[model samples]
Target: MSQRVVLGLSGGVDSAVAAYMLKKQGYDVICVFMRNWDSQLNNDILGNPTNNDPVCSQEMDYNDAKAVADALGLELKRVDFIKEYWDHVFTYFLDEYGKGRTPNPDILCNKEIKFKAFLQYAEELDADYIATGHYARVEHRDGDDVMLRGVDGNKDQTYFLCQLNQHQLKKSLFPIGELTKPEVRQIAHDLHLPVADKKDSTGICFIGERDFREFLKNYIPAKPGKIVDYATKKVIGEHQGIMYYTIGQRRGLEIGGKGGPWFVIGKEYDQNILYVASGDSNQWLLSDEALITGVNWISSTKPEGDFDCTAKFRYRQKDNDVSIRFINEDTIYVTFKKPIKAVTPGQAAVFYDGEVCLGGGTIDKVYHNNKELEYL
Candidate 1:
């Protein structure tokens, strides 16, 4: 009998192609459509698709996943993770935002919703392994297991997946890690999958299909604020609210005095003050080292001593060389070889060594010995 691999089909080209590849490799495949959110959230008129930005085509997505599974000649199962998402992801998102901290809910969603839920579901179905379309590699490191980056540098998703513990990586399978996004699309095209041309999913998972602010409006009550340059204390613009904005944002600021270009430097939640500054100010916006807290080592043994590796502080950030020094059981200090721009708080800083994912943690604070941004 062939090994059976239960796959998570997310109604996208990547997951569809993953199903095909696993079947072709002689694994007895069963594709599962993870219903992380209920459809009623979309069909409800008050919570209509137009009202919320994240609630896109749930019916279409569920159908697409089902159709792909049928076409691949596999049994399809749907698991509802609504309760888990609410308890773990949504609560964290709202709490972090409430505290003026920008949390990466996607990371929490992966940790609490998809992998954790799907793995349990797969075990109940007597499967050998659970698989998904993430662009990261999982390998046996020295007898223990670890995850690494994908072969395609441009589309690597290990950053979002850094929170996975050793046990999770031990059983996870990322079918598209060895291939690039274009290559995965090609595979889907070759397989004649329905989602061959389907656009990749973006933004916070399961909060689909709503204008971000409009969707957020339902959750977080808005508060308007003034945009001022911290250096000059001159009110150059007015913002919708500090909650809607993010660090390093350039557009929609509505600032004048275009001496250069102003970007979001920081926000003062208590005072309702949004700080704007020239985009080119390295001293105010950039930093070399940051203290990352809540570290998770996918390996059983945490790395000790000064270790050199590449890390990404936020999603879409290019890899940069860094020296990571373990500070304690729960923290580490990462010194970038060169100053990295906008090392934002409440983001994950994932370290890597080629395809092997070292580990990662939450960014808590940035520091410069004598001359640092006084406000931060």
Candidate 2:
């Protein structure tokens, strides 16, 4: 009997091509569609509070995923992880934002939902391995698994999967990790998959192409706050809410006619103040050191003492050379060789050793010139 491999068909070209490749590899491929969100939770993305109509995008995605599964002659299963997502990921997301911190829910979703919830469900289905179309690779060496970046740097998604541990890595497969986005699209087109021409989904995975601020208001009540200039400490404008903004955000400030485009440097949650600074290269936004917590080493072990590595403060950011010293079991003090921009608390700082992902943690504190910022 062929080994069973459950593939997450996300109704995207990448996953569709992944399914095709898995079937070609002669594994018993089973397609699973993870329903992680409920569209009935809020109004439409346009901020219309009266619009109670349910969105059909999730249904449409399921249909597309079913079509691909049928084309590949694989059994399709639908799993609802909405509750799990709410309990494990969404609550933490809201809590972080409530604390005036920008949290990456996608990273939490991967660790809590896809790998934990979905992986457990897949195991119940008697599958040997579960796979996703994520642009990352897993390798086994020295009786341990190591996660690596995808061959296509532009589409590499290792940052999101940085929280994954050794057990999860061992059972996961990324079939399209070695292929570029164009190549994945081409393969999907050649296979005549339904999602071949479908536009890639952006923004939050569950929220789909929605206005972020409007969607956020559905859960968190918008609190009007004063936007203060970081340099002069002058109140320049009002903000909808501190939760709606993030570090280094420049647009939607409504502070036009100002000397320069203003970037968010800090948030004072106690005072509900949004701190902004003029110029793109504001010194307040740059930091040379950070304290990270909730660290998960993928190998299930921490490196001894301080060591050199590269890290990414955000997705799509170029790696920065850094030295990491373990402060404790779940914390690390990272000193960047050069100051990095907008090292926001609550966002992850994923470390890497070349192509290999070395795990990471949430940035809990940021320091400039060895002085910790008071606002964070």
Candidate 3:
């Protein structure tokens, strides 16, 4: 009997091509679509009027996924993960925003929903392995599974998958890991997949194309606050809420200031104040060190002492050289070789050792010149 592989067939070009590749590899491919959010249900929570569209985005995606599964002559299953997503991912998202910190829910979604909950469902299906459209690679080396950067440098998604554990990596496969975005699209086109020309989804998966602030306001009531100039300490403008903004945000501040286009320098959560700096390269924007918590090293054995490696504070950011020292089993004090700008608390700090992905953690604190940034 052929090895049965369960593939997550998201209604996108990447996963469509992934299913094609898996089938070509002679595995018994089964497709699974994860329904994690509902726009109407969320609207009800906010007490806001819901859209009248008969078919929701998730349903449209399911239709696309089903088309691809049928085209490839495979069995497709739809699973509901709404409750799990709410408890594990969305709750954390709201809590972080409430605390005046930026949170990457995509990372948590992968950790809690796709990998954890989805993997469990796959196991119950008696599948030999599970796979996704993510642009990342897993290599088995000498009795260990190592997650590596995908071949496509520009589209590498290992940062989001950095929270995945050893067992998850061991059981997961990325069929499109070796292909570029263009190449994946080409394969889909050649296969005549239904989502061949579908546009890539952006922003948060649950929020879709909705305005982020408006979506957030439904959950967290807007508290109008003062936007102050960091240097002058003068009230520049007013903001809707601190939870709607983030460190390093430049646009959307309606400040008619003398000096700047203004970048968010710091946020005083207690005072409900959002501070802005004039220049992009302002001193307040840079930081030489950060304290990260809930760190997860992929390898079972943690490094003994301080070690040199590189890290990315955000998904698209370039790696920065850093020295890591364990504060405890789940914490690390990272000293950036050069000052990094806008290393926001509550955002993830994913570590990398060249192409190999080291597990990462949430950034709990940021410091400059040995003083913790208390404002943000």
Least accurate 10 contiguous residues by lDDT in model 2: 39-48
What tens digits encode model 3's per-residue C-alpha lDDT throughout 1-376?
9998999888888988899999999999989999988767755665768554233477788899999999989899999898898889888889888878889999989988889999999999998899999999999666779999999999999999988888888899999999999999889888888899999888775446666777677677789999998788898799989888878888888776457878887889889999888865547778999999988888877787899999999999999999999979899999999999889999999999999999899999899999998777
Model 1 regions more than 4 Å off: 39-55, 257-260, 370-376
Give the lDDT ranking, best first.
Answer: 2, 3, 1
For model 2, state the Cα shift of residue 176 in Å: 0.5
| TM-scores for every predicted model | 0.92, 0.95, 0.95
Give candidates' CA RMSD values in order. Answer: 2.8, 2.7, 2.0
State model 1's lDDT: 0.80
Candidate 1: worst-modelled 10 consecutive residues by lDDT: 42-51
Off by over 4 Å in 2: 41-56
Distance from true location, Cα of 325 in model 1, Å: 1.6
TM-score computed on alpha carbons, candidate 3? 0.95
Assess each prediction's global lDDT (C-alpha) against the native. Answer: 0.80, 0.87, 0.87
